[model samples]
Target: MKTLSIDIETYSPIDLTRSGVYKYTESPDFQLLLFGYAVDEAEVHVVDLASGRKIPEDVLSALTNPLITKWAFNANFERICLSRYLREHYPDYFTSYGEDVATAKYLDPLGWKCTMVLSASLGLPLSLKAVGQALQLEEQKMEEGTRLIRKFSVPGLQGRVLPKDSPEDWELFKSYNRRDVEVEMEIRKALEPFFVSPNLWDEYRRDQDINDRGILVDRNFVESAMAMGKRAQEEITGRLQQLTGLANPRSPVQMKKWLFSKDHITHTLCKKERAHFIAHTSGDIHEALVLYSQAQKSSLAKYGAMADSACSDGRARGMFQFYGAARSGRWAGRRIQLQNLPRNSMEDLDLARKMVKDWDYEKLSFFYDEVTDVLSQLIRTAFIPRKGYKFIVSDFSAIEARVLSYMAGERWRMEVFAKDGDIYAASASAMFHVPVVKHGIHGDLRQKGKIAELALGYGGGEGALKAMGALDMGLTEEELKPLVTSWRATNPHIVDFWWKIDRAVKEAIENHRIMRVGTLTIFMQKGILFIELPSGRRLSYVGAAMKMGEKGYKTITYMGVGATKKWERIESYGPKFVENIVQAVSRDILCHGMKNLQDRYICGHVHDELIIECPEDTPVYEITETMAQMPDWMPGLVMRADGYETEYYRKE
Candidate 1:
């Protein structure tokens, strides 16, 4: 058999949602109940493993055979689960497959293909059911699978419903397993035209390797932080109760009512509002508001997540999801979202971490005023390298800005990057027509320039400025309009690039023609709008069309996963498309860099940063220099990487 389409039903006492699949499978009670398979275009078959039936020997041989490709919806789940199964039941075959099962830790991903990744590559939904519905497949996923899974797979639910107890459900469960393989095969057939590139598959394999490598968690640090967070929360709750005399100060409704009744404050007690009230009010009200804001800091929850998802070896796996952001094809964070970890700005992070690990609450409180906030800032430190190794954390410097400049032919922005100069100050200088420095003459304008650069990059105007907190940064509402105009006026090429892309997209959809904007190519293929990036990776827009807007201009629209995460038709324009292109290119660059450094023990990555677990003697510049090397697709794009060596992971 050239291809093996498979699906599995697993039973585990571990909470798969809370702990990741790696930890879930580590449970001794974990069992692969049903193994369903279809070899090539043959009839689907279900091997009831839970009832003592064994998988066919030929099919089992095909699993370890590198020539035979295995296909599944979320293939990672199947590949990992089957790896455990093979090692346990078919030890000889598992060990003789060419790689050491002990050190390699799982099945080689080179022989596996994920249909979920394929669906995502086409800008389709990631779920099996959603993709089947989106593709209008003849064999759709069974809706009854969820109920049957809950009945049999889950443990401690009314004393574990077994096939002996519910024979009818058992038959349906086997059918559900068989139908999943059929649906997966149908998805592959439907998406056969848009074949996923080998490079992308190679990148997916690298992602799997990184996930399997798993980052070591500082168990002592995580446990201490969690315990400290609990105690700190109790103390803060008691203080708020004593001061406000409210039933629950943590409750927003209760706090808002109390604040309005006592202090005449009527605004919502969100982060910004709480800060405002604390600054304005005095005495117990001020103290209580400050305490309330401190209590609301949820960064410490990451510690709990790290603790939960960590495997028996004290490493967290499956934290990054490939193509999680389908629009830009950026990897999304799973279980313990390393993507959005709170920035650590504490001057004495090492001291605070040491105190917490020592469980010295008194010293910690003495050294830090807001102890809970300290814990929040120390969250990143929980991910530590294993003994005898250090984490060499490196990241591209202002990657998005550099990529936008390179693509738009913004010369001065490129110049800034080339010289390793400050883009924020350069942008401010260009916009205001004055020499702007970070802490020198007219340095105040740098903040305005920084905010303007961030907000106005994607064709944002006054509203974007406000959303970026311009008013809080001391910029007036009147200044936002002029700042946007000034930014656009200074970066004329970028503005032109935006409209050029906009016009190209409009032409591609309306005229049914291929259009080129700068180094990017836009075309419509079978109702899908493909924007081919310089890296040769295409960003897809499904069901693309153009309609006359109320403003008398043609507005481009496409079917995509929207803000609410439902598949629907969404409107788009040039600047937005430019944003996607630039970010996607940045992602490609990151993947390229990771490929360059693949020989190193790269544990994990967060956005543009790569966290490498290496010997303490490894030079930090070696990793940074390799990452800064530009790809062959874009010759003139100036790239720079900066890094720091740390025993534990942290934002430097």
Candidate 2:
């Protein structure tokens, strides 16, 4: 097959970060400035479209000719942007590409390839420069690329201002564009040794399709919600000011100093500090902190973002990034973060949403405890179904717990999942060795079980319990160690699995050997630590080696982007690896479910849930049943999905 490797410089007046590529390209002012391409292994070419050069007839024809493949890093941007450019410049070729089934406005995605997706699947960095450096490709991306992008690709001002330099700068920008194509071609070549599976590529297409078929946003609800939030915040700020006499109680430093001045209380107000306050504070101080919390919640940018993210079609798309969490293969949420949505617990959700939508601030203030919190809970409700359809929100029950138990050969836990049992209550019973039930015998002990299950799954101790909020749950300091001991004793097999796998991983790294624990194959090869999961996908740790840290213990180290999202050396241990395995497998299971229902209209998904668009009376149980079927590699792992239909997505 012929390949047209591409890299382009474009200008969009719209904020592409907030409104994704599809919406970004829809802008009237959007322009493809430079088009750089290479045919197969041929020399690269640059077409300065901004300076009024036309794309070659053959290159434009290749786009609509399905046999001529198109490749780019983050190909969604290139593909969608090209679709727009083609529609404007070469309608004949654009029309011939055929309409997309989901969003008929776009060209076909059949031959599009994303090198970023390829890098992510292999656990390489997502950035073009980073991937090139990691793979040590001889043809590196130009360092001047960033500066050139700011000069040329930035919105509004690029066409107006000629920089301090001249035609030479434009030439440099063109060279940068050409170099990007060269780097991208080299990357594709480097990755060809372990090219991503066709199935994974298909999954990438599905992701792009979903992003194109964005979920509907209730504009009325969103607009009213934003207004109500502002009003509520103003009221709260006024109250807080009257009570505290602080000039800016919303400022953390000001609030801390004010609290100290009030009662000589000086302490760190970080997570641990705030957790202590929630557990131990009282009187006026507690009221002040709670008010501050509400004000903080009110100021969440998501409410405003919902309005911005909604396209002209009244739908918000591109909230998901496929292969975003490189380790777990999970789709990370972007802009309005569905994966991290606040769980709605309002008893009368419809009433609360209606009040906010109606902009009845007084009704919300009187009926609800905190109007800002109400706005926070109502965020998910903003994502509504399209005009004629309803959303069927369904999710796997205790998927990670079930996967962990099944992987560890825990029969009792499997039985619980097989019967659709409440794992929290069952876990509490197992830990307490009592009839710990949900609102039944020793019901109070369920919290202990819940916290333990959350914290202690991967060889955690009392510190983990504290981190998981045992203290906030009102457990005594003395009871923490005992609780950890009891939970470990109860789930002896799980604990054993953690340490057994730990030993095997360390040995595999240290001796440069293969270690098989359960169906997982752990080995070190060519400076990369590979864990071949039962699903046949491998978790990669590039430039991996064991290093003894300042903590005086040797641990596994690898090259990765840290919390700050910069390339650096990352450290890990046995429990963390176990976490990666469980999450990756859980993510794979969700992917499998999504793929199984390919014909179904899956509009959006939270971590473990899939929100499908269907008719009001559609049989949702079949969706759940289909999702529960385990793949061939995942035998004896029982899974269950629960679902409910709604006009919009919710916690149900």
Clashes of each: 0, 0
> For candidate 1, which ten residues in a row score worst on lDDT?
95-104
List model 2 lDDT by residue over 1-652, tens digit each.
Answer: 3999998989877777777777788888889988999998699999988878888899998886767789999888888888888888787888422243447667677778888988888888889999999888999999998787777666435364343345888888888899999999998887776634457877787888788778889999989888888888888899899889998889988988997787747566664676567567787788888888777673357878788788788888778888999888889888878888788888889999888788788888998887787788888898887778898888998899999998888788888888888788888888777887789889999988888889989878899988887887889899988888888888878887887778887888889989999999988877778888887878888778889887998877888888888888898878888899999999888888888998888889888999999987798898899888878889878888888888877886
TM-score for each model = 0.98, 0.94
lDDT of 1 by residue, 186-243 (tens): 9888888874655888999899888887898989889999999999999999999999
For candidate 2, the per-residue lDDT at 133 reads 92
Which residue segments of model 1 deviate by more than 4 Å?
95-103, 548-554
User: What TM-score should be assigned to candidate 1?
Assistant: 0.98
- Scored by lDDT, the top model is 1
lDDT of 2 at 496: 77
- For each candidate, the alpha-carbon lDDT, in order, equals 0.89, 0.83
The predictions' CA RMSDs to the true structure, in order, are 1.6, 2.4
